[model samples]
Target: MVEISIVISLILIFDSYLLGKCISKYFNWNADYFPIITIGFFVILGIFEFFVFAFVKFQFSVYYILFVQYILLIIPIFVAIKVKVNLIPTQKELKMILGGALFTIIFAFLMGNQTLGEAAFDSNFYLSMVIENSTSPTLGTINGYTGNIENISTLHGYQGFYYFHSLLLKNIRNILSLNNTSLTPVYLWTSALTYFYMLSDILFHSINLFLEKKSLHTKIVALFFVLVFFTNYFNISFPFYGNTWKTLNIACNMLILYEFIKLNNKKSLFLLTFLNSSLIGFSSSGFFIACFIEISFFFYLIWKKEQNYTIYLEYWISCLSLLIFALLYFSGNYTKISILILAIYCLAGYTVYLTKRFDAIFWKKLLQFFKFIFLISVLLLVIVSYFVRNSMFSGSDSQFNGYSFFFRLNSLGDMTLNYFIPVNKIEFVRNCVFWFIIFINCFQGKYEKEYKFFLLLIIILFVNPFVTPFVVKYMTSIVYSRCFEIFINPFCLLIFYTGLIEWLEKNKNIEILFLLALEIGSIGIIVHNNISYYSKFFIPQKGYNPVYRVTNDQWELYQNLIEELQSSKLERPLILNQDIAVKAYVSNIRVLIDANTSRSAPAYSDENIDAPSDWLNIFYVRDYYGQHIWKQDPDYSKICDAIIDSNCDYVIMDKEVVVLKGDLYLPLWFDARGCSEVIYDNDRYVLLRVRK
Candidate 1:
């Protein structure tokens, strides 16, 4: 246990430091977020540790340890270094030091010695995450997950990700010869921590940057953006475990931006080039696409301002190198490196224009500039082509209407959270629910020119999905490919808030009042929305939910329900009433068919045959993957069929949703056919058995 503890600490340190070093080295920025990040990491670990030590042997195995501790310390750094990433231990050290006091204070408040580590679900999830960790210790792989990712395991759509991660986890499980899968509470908390801290990193930098340019009053506004964007109402609403990494991608992208803004050296340029490239590549194309927007804006700024490409030519080369590396490393088997090569060919061809056009001294500089810009443009075109191919191929079906609808209604509530000023002694959260709507407007409107640019770029980030939610909803419901879009809306908000705060620094009264309103609104919305949504469904999720009050009581409550399900003698299979619910999925349990995937098929699939698609919903609804399934009606035939066909046992699902009343009678259909029976019931959910 001690050895394991040490290993955990090392991993945490390595993870934090590697990111810190890379940020400082390549971006030449003062990004020392270790205190908060470390606290977040450890607080989460400590939460789980309480339960682990409480029940387990707590034995010490440091002596017999494989001595991988050293590797743990250096691997992340080495990887960054091998890539010749320029990191700044000195600047990072200072940030870590200076930021330490504040981090300690905030962390203590966030954690408060309440080790929330106790197991909240079946041990299968626990064992799976551990066994899975042994084989695939690859960088960026979230250590472990709880659910089985077989054909039938989805709650909504075909989870291309679930399958992908499962393959890696299964291999590790096999090395240890484990036959079952499980997720630990620690896995949940750690994963959550990873995402939260990723956002915190962005908030930290953006806030600090805002602080640099603004007054004390304006500082608060900047902080407001920092908090709101990180605690995006949408994310707080629909935070599934799978989507946790999506949050990470956004924070990482922001950090990349913050770094990009502070680049001071070739090394920093090089690292920013790679880190941002890889982050967006692996995390999602949306973030990288956002990065592209940033790149384009920067290029326009550089070229338009100086009217010369030679000045930033090296940086462009670095970008090219990073792009090449990203394609080589981050691309899947289907990746096309040749796309970039083609751009290179065009660039070389374009150089003919430069060579023929050059005469003497006057023309030489012009010719050189043309050649450099032409080459860079060619390289860039190749990169763009690769993305275009990926985009054209990647067909998704998520609707923005669902997300947009949720955001508008909840904006007030989110503002409440933002204005929730922790007075340290207040036993209860201050209910500033009143200011939500008014303050939420703080996030809206044209704030700053730079902010406006960010907002416009953010909208442009939705370029891949030209069709809005109306089209998407009517076209494709419950498709898995639409998951990436989940982050775009909130992330754009984050960038906007960042830009807004930066613009608001000129006014003190505006900053403070703006912050108060913003915080109160965001927090209130989350807490209220969370509670209201869960009254019936009882899962940790949000979306398409309509009701009264504000805040996320449902989410907080599910933490306990998750506790009950995990430790209950019955070991109920976790069921989700709605797909947008974050906790149900993040809990890493196999779920009943849900919002994650849909039951419908779209014509686009037939029309865009080559549109690389993820039929996630089909797998679950049709039992193609043999995942967990449950019905509300105690039907014999359907249950029997499900058990025989999909190996389902007990199914725990909500049966009281008014909108779903028609479908909820599926169990009744089974009973009419004489297939299944009810085993348990509550006001919210009805449990049934098919295997027996």
Candidate 2:
């Protein structure tokens, strides 16, 4: 907990403020938003490094990433010193930091113990990727599940957050002298803190946006309202456990919304474009969200009649270049989506060109026509994707069900209902009823144009399958619920908070009573429903918790296994261990087979074949390595023969299984077929040296 506090403070204070200050010079943003902008900058920098590593083909190490972060850190420090800029946080900034930290601590306490949900889920792979990045020279190019060379561009393009995780994990290990035994807890805590910081920053900035002069009381009140109504009420606990990439995605989208609302100059536009690029590599549906935000921002600019064609051209061109890079370097449906977004930005640039050159009503009409075409194109894409969802995702059927026109329609309807239906725990505030009041308030109150824009976005993109089909899988995917909870829920709260603040301002006499009642009520509900219902949302996670993913015993086994593997004579010795908990820590070693495949197959065997070509290798390997399936203990000679046949240098097995007789154990195999020497033994696991 102390370490978590230190890391969070270091990030919020130094990395966020200083590094943010340096980048803000280039991007030009308010100093108040430096924390989020710094985070956004890191997201972009991390992605840039991801591409650099993938395209340039270099041996990667923790030092490489550390060097990059140090460079970023030094630049800001140098600038602040040279310019004599004050580096200390102001009293107001200190309050924001303390407030955010308090919320984070509360969140951590609520989300107690966690575990990796399933073996085949993306979280397992993401864990492996981070470990690989931390220790292996292959960086993210090698697949942890299969010891095969995988192009990072294909599978890991949108997962740049892994690089960030790798960076933090390495720093923690180096700073604290912790080993793989401490990795899981540290990783979990760091990830949750990072998300909380991003979220808190969003809330703080949002409050200021609404209130003209935000006092400490007002800020705290607004934060409490959002933390309860938006964060606690929404079932966003999945990200805190292991799906941290989604949390980052949600944070990035919130930052995008913030920038979109405050976008008045070229700096905000540049930030938005950079954020869009980062989203392209964030997650599976990252680009879908990016496109939704981009199109809305584009239209917002046009509607405001703030068409500085040159600035718009610069922004579109910047997006165009990044989109083309993503298209060329990456594969899958996202690339296809990128082509569409790329074309839209390109066409938008051309239209801006024509509108600037001709300055005619005709060109303006053409721009309007292009907008309609874009909408129609998006609708057609969704319809086509729906029809071919089964074929396109034949292997990955777990992500989406077999396609039916009626099923798609039913899914959309269900999503609409889910958006308005509050969770069972917080039934007092039905989302539908809350939204109804807010919708009426939008017409009743005097608000900024951008506030209405946010409202419009919630109505259109919150449950619109056609708009977010790629990310939401036509509102049928398991991620659909969590996505909206993080994606649309915050914006809704912002609007609601704005209206509430205005109403409170008009009736100052009852301000304290209203806030006190709401705060007390929200806290009461949270305490009543302390147990998270995230697991029951859509997919049944076999072993899901909100905190530490690996158990103490499992972590001890990992440390022991790693110690033995490190002492081996062979360079990159191949060891075979089927313990699922050991998967996150063994990325540096060459494993004969994936532990995730052996451990998680029973639970997620149906969903294992998400992609035919991709998962067939895993299934084939699992068939041969029947450690879990084959119940009988084989002869010592047979076990030795199996190890040698598989070309594995070492094998770690349970102490109970490697017995020569009932109570006897063999030091070395003495058989004609093959031989193995007992190199290391523990109460739980036995490590054997397989000889050729």
Candidate 3:
């Protein structure tokens, strides 16, 4: 498995280098900045996968996709070879790369070795889908609980967004000839490591761009700050166990920012559009973040009076093209109409420019005002239409109830504020002092442009939650707001540090000593927090029990359960507790209940009610809240009879279920129906065979 992972890593690096060189040439960027280009390459690759799955309507397969990629690369590879781009790195660059690699490996090892015993259902649910799709080659795989093929693409919205990660895992599986269960750790580690490495590379490059005179010591310090901030600050809210997609999207956003800062021509427009659209393939929040940033940049350009007609033409063309592609592939009516409106807007803008109407002072001012209004109005309409179409702001009686709305808003507010002032006391004080330095230097006018841009981002994120109640009805406000923070917080920190270093360059020795002391103290706080959190896994800490640790007995018990189920040869759906579904799916067996029921399970027969005899619903609710309402219900016998008459061929009860449902009721209910036989019994679990 390790050898297979190394091979996959090599393939990824080679492909990224080739594709990066081609993209850098197209955009007229220096070939030395191929690492940034590599980030763009992955973004484009994900978008390509989405298009293939969307239009082709076939199951995702690594071999077929790679074949297409290689064929398409022939032209670029030929051009690159003719150009003879230098792919080697200088000593300094190589050292930075190696340093980033070492950090990523250590982080990935920690993340992978952690037990999955307490992993979030969301994480396991996506992993199960990836594993299932690999074997079957279809996104519409049968639901573990209901045995129905679901159109998960439309239901989840993020199904195609993370396909690239799934593709990598599938490739690893094929190369190693390993089963899904054995490769679970590899999947977790590889995905986390790759994303972090890309993020580290982007951060390093962005910092270098900000500070043109890069030094070895400065580079190492910057890398340390980036690693510490991300691992500590982000982990407070977004942990590595369940939020892998979020982490990847955040990194992609930073990559977009790097590109935006360097925008020069039509090629840059294309690259931005491609990268933004790729976010839509990953997560809805990511897509929105991309759109927001693109629109903001558009406004900034117009505000600055960048009268390059070609740039405007390229911008509008990319927007129109991207929306049209989104409409065709994703089948969103909003995207369809967005293209039409954008076309009209672009035409009007072009008319003003072509006619030289902006030559006169009054006319120029008036036209600028009108342009601002037009752009802002169009953006507002798009946002409003999204909420309306999704019924997010329906009514008080809707799922967007008062409690949920308030709770979401509060959570968003807390999270946004926490990003600036961390929850930990020492870190909070250090962050406060750091921000104080930035605030005091805000009036110096040295970084006015950066201040304006990032300040606008900060304001939007801070205000989003407060206004969300009026705009979107049913959506989780925190989720939407957190997306912005995830994308913006890292950039904010980068900008702050960049400004600090610039200040230190000009300031006196005493001022430099004071600032250096503050920064070092901040770094120390972050490192302490990380060490404290990570240490709980090995050495137990008071009031901080590690979630990702399982005992030897529990591991052995689950291994036995998996082995028995695999050899059962049962032809009917196995009824399992919801908690056990992850194990079942990893073992490549079908179960009757799992966490992925939002789109998979059958719809309710009546509104506000579920059938009492529905095994899926019973176990779903039980596992969801860890409560056994089924056993205590007055209609328990009837529900048991219904399940007995259904197609359920086996029932597996773990210790939790046995404790909740009790030995007497479970055994008597099945025995009385004369359809169940005790097959296996142990202290940790019980297995029953249902007669056909």
Candidate 4:
């Protein structure tokens, strides 16, 4: 497996290099920056893969994707090999890269090997999608509860957004000849490492640009930036956060923002536009960030009086193309409508550009003004309507609720302080004094514009948590307070680092002390957090603890159940409780349901359940497990009929059911329904064979 993982990594690196070389030639970037460029190109390639498999209707196979990818690499490889370019990094840069990679590997290894966290379910869902897509030709959900392939379009529009990571893992699994369970750790490690590389490269470039230096010290500072943001400690204990596709989105947007700020050439502009549009295919958060950045750039150009109408034209064109692509790729009517509204916004911007270019009579100008006003009004209405619709219909979770505005505000403060300064009182005081010095220095007017921009970003980050409650109230079902941590924490660190660097340049004597203190404090926090995280798994008493870490016994039990199911050769779909669904999905078996829904499993109701009719009925049966048997209820009869009609061939109940729902309900319900045959039983789990 190790050998195969290395081979797969090499393939990705080679492909990234070839694509990066082509982009470098077009953009006139230095060859030493190939690795950084390669990270961006890798994301571009993943987007291309998604488009081919989804809209282009290409077969969803690893070989097909790679064959095409490699074929496309030939031209760039040939061109790059023939050209004389200084592709080698400086010694200092090499050391930084190696050090960052080593640190990332060690951290990812620890994270992957430790017990599961909140993101484990999401990781499993992504893995299952990869397995299904790789084994089957079609791109759709496997209906984990029913084994039926449902069009992914109807389920969720962003299905293709996450396929990038899934495809990578699928390739790894295919090459390693490993099962999904074994590949879980590898997926975590690879995804985290890739994110670290991309982030480190971005920081290296940004810091080098800012300091006008690329020494060993600068490299160390770059690593410091990476460690500061990428650690689980800074990110609110989200160890498996790397498994989500949003990480890729964040990296791409940050890099795109940097490129937009630095480069203004046509080729670079085109690439930036392409990157902006590509975010639409990744995640909605990316789309939001891209829109914000693009709009901000448009205004910046206007403010700078650049008079580059062509840039404006490219921006509008890209916006329109993104809208059309979203319409084609995304199934939700609201999503498509949102894209159309954004297109109208682009249209309004174009009209404003035209008004500035071509002189018009009073009546014509008046007419254009009214048209723009009408467009703006419509845009506002569309946005408000969507928000209202979501608020009215979306399901809520108790865990996400109860976060008061003040509490969230306070949490942000602690997160920001801990992110930069040490948690102890003395270190915190020292950091605050240093921060005041940096603040005074920043006002001295060197890089005034840059400081202003950073200040604006800091303000936005600080206020975002306060705004999240209202956003969740009016626009989304899930709480995005966690998302604020993922997106804002990096900028908070960057802003502080920028200020610190400026201060360090003036106060050389304090530089070494600050760096030393930072290293020690950062490492200490990471070690402490990791120890706390892993210690939960070793606690003696456990009966469905809220912080449910996967135990070795439970893992073995799940494996045994999979083996039994395989031996049974059951044709019908298997039903698995939400808690064990992740492991069950790893078996690559067709399931009636796996826990990928928006709401908590126990809180599921008829209106919010995302499953087949029959499977949903069975879900309700198990969901209300010990609650007074609703055998007399119509819904209960529906569940019994579904079970008796062969909707599910098997059911796996974990020990949590007995603890939470009691054992009496399962037996009584089965006997009353007269449809289930007990096949396997133990203290930890139970398996039932549903009869036709």
The global C-alpha lDDT for each of the candidates, from Candidate 1 onward, is: 0.37, 0.52, 0.50, 0.48
lDDT ranking, high to low? 2, 3, 4, 1
Candidate 3 residues 370-417, lDDT tens each?
Answer: 566756655674466445543444453355533234234222222233
Measured by TM-score, the strongest candidate is 3
Comparison by TM-score, 1 against 2, better one: 2
Q: Rank the candidates by TM-score, best first.
A: 3, 2, 4, 1
Candidates' RMSD to native: 13.1, 6.9, 6.7, 7.7
What is the clash count for each candidate, in the order shown?
Answer: 89, 3, 7, 7
Q: Which is better, 2 or 4, measured by TM-score?
A: 2
CA-RMSD of model 2 = 6.9
Worst 10 residues of 2 by lDDT: 611-620
Indicate the residue-level lDDT of 247 in model 3: 46
What is residue 527's positional error in candidate 3, in angstroms? 4.5
Better of 2 and 3 by TM-score: 3
TM-score of each: 0.49, 0.73, 0.74, 0.69
- lDDT for 381 in candidate 3 is 48
